[model samples]
Target: MNVMKSTGKFRDESLDFQKKILERSGFGEGTYAPTSLLKTPPNVCLAEARKETESVVIGAIAELLSRTKVKAEEIGIVVTNCCVFNPTPSLSAMVVNHYKLRDNVVSYNLSGMGCSAGLISIELAKQLLQVRPNSYALIVSTENINDGLYFGNNRSMLVSNCLFRMGGAAILLSNLTSDSHRSKYCLKHIVRTHKGSQNHCYNSIIQEEDDDNITGVTLSKNIMSSAGQTLKANISTLGKYVLPFSEQLRFVTNFVAKKLFFKVRVIKSFTPNFMLAFEHFCIHTGGKAVQDEMQKVLGLSDWHMEPSRMTLYRYGNTSSSSVWYELAYCEAQGRVKKGDRIWQIAFGSGFKCNSVVWCALRTIDPTKEKNLWSEFSTHVTN
Candidate 1:
């Protein structure tokens, strides 16, 4: 990765700033850095943006196409999402042009959707697939950290600089019955809950200029509270679809008792045991605090949280792609099995809590060598 080369330059240029952010941020010393920051002149220009896009999106797409043996012309629809970087030609357009896709191929570029945008793109792809039979959709999720780097002294903004890193993921979704036989997982359900109507939720993560006109994404202090509120709302809806009958009954009973029986202290609040619903979890690698809170809220053990923690440590927060890395980690660890349900939950800037439930269609071998987590297998397995 270009990150290793840039580490020295970053430290030499701004050692104190990097040190301070590292001390407080949940990132380790090995998080990926953008090539933009590593450049001699430190590029944040259009060329740099395209380079980053090509390096991640194109590379991932090539690998996906090669593995799936799907030609570029077969992609009926394409959706690419990036929160901070949206060029004039659009990233989707670039992909279409690079791959020489069919002129009628539907393409969309989603921007400013934040980390949860990956699942959002998947949700969109699922909807599109319903309309177009026997078709495939390509989804690319990435963040341009080079352009998003914050040089200002704002602590809230600096946190983003420390937390976010370079990464991307490309996923191919097919609705063809034939492809289903070969697919690793099947999309079961997607639940998206947005709390942006509330002021705090809207401002929880935002891009704005500091007093010195330096731009950065500022994370608000109320992020944790806002995230909790949104997660509660999201899971409440998600529970009805995925939770077992017995768990649903218990949750409803507790909720009713808490609401109707004001004088009784029988139940404070209904916290459904998410562990009962899903066999595995691919929670967004937002940060240490977010992962810790999610583990506690869902009553997950350290084994269940290994993917999120390890992803954060290894890649930092890759924005929308973090969840994919977590999923990949589970596959590398051989934790995902046939018929096992995996829940991917992510929180975004809109104070959105989005979840996608996937059922493993086939067992994945833990000995896969090409996976991103393959290098860290020893550490993860031990």
Candidate 2:
């Protein structure tokens, strides 16, 4: 406190801004933050950063292997994503070393991909499984922003402090025919969109050093606009693959008729009824504002958006892993039926939007599955 006061960094006005952000964040008191960050004078350091990540990442992986009854050696591919914290050895290497995975394991660590990196990792794993027969892939999605908090006076950067909280997930993927019966869901389609070509889009949400030389992720007001535009491009490609022929033809006919009727060269508005393609929606729980914006853009009902909104209020923003938490909420509520098409959508830094579609092989058994939201599931009908 003395050091912060001496430097005239922490001010009374900043407290007001943070307090306002907290009220509208839709984050409950249960949201987890690393103990280091909760300190009066935050004990932010490299060692603490490493400890924070490993605790979440490794613990999640251990629980995954235990529940799945799969040995670490059986994982032929490992993909780990930690957007803000990429160490010298890489997160994948850490998983490899901890699990004592095979020497020939195909491993990768991705950074700077932001919240959408989870779907990117899943997309990569799904593709790899096709070529590498009889193999299993493990993906760990997390954010280690415990030490990345902004202490500077930049309000854009201050948004980061309110938006993110601690969370991680470990997912196992397989391609073996023998494991087919055991697999819960199968990947149907994945669409990735990037708008980084435009300078404004690329700078939508970025990590940089402030004037005080304190580094943090800057989230501009343009983030929602960039996300909405990029998602238009993403679902445009995804629609052809997932939407029924009837829905597709209707959308095109209506779109063209509007343009022709108005004699306008372009139609600035069009959103396919994603409900036609998906039975369940798992939009990323980035924050209250992002969730609210996407809800409007997608024209989703409160029922379809319950998991996302609930996850945000419960777990806060887990970055790349937020979608998984949302999906878990659906499963916990016993809403996933057999043959259900689940749409997982995410918006990230680099002004990227990605969608992963899945089909459940069988009706999920809530008791048999990992019930992350069991406590809330009882009282919450949605």
What TM-score would every model get versus the actual structure? 0.93, 0.95
lDDT of each: 0.87, 0.87
User: Residue 313 CA error for candidate 1 (Å)?
Assistant: 1.0
Stretch of 10 with least lDDT, candidate 2: 1-10
Which runs in model 2 stand beyond 4 Å of their true positions? 1-8, 258-268
Q: Write candidate 2's Cα lDDT for 102-196 as tens digits.
A: 99999999998999999999988888888889999999999986666777778898878888899999999998888889887988888999999
Tens-digit per-residue lDDT, 186-221, candidate 1: 999999999999999999999998776777798999
For model 1, the superposed segments whose C-alpha errors exceed 4 Å read 1-18, 39-41, 262-266
What global local distance difference test value does model 1 have?
0.87
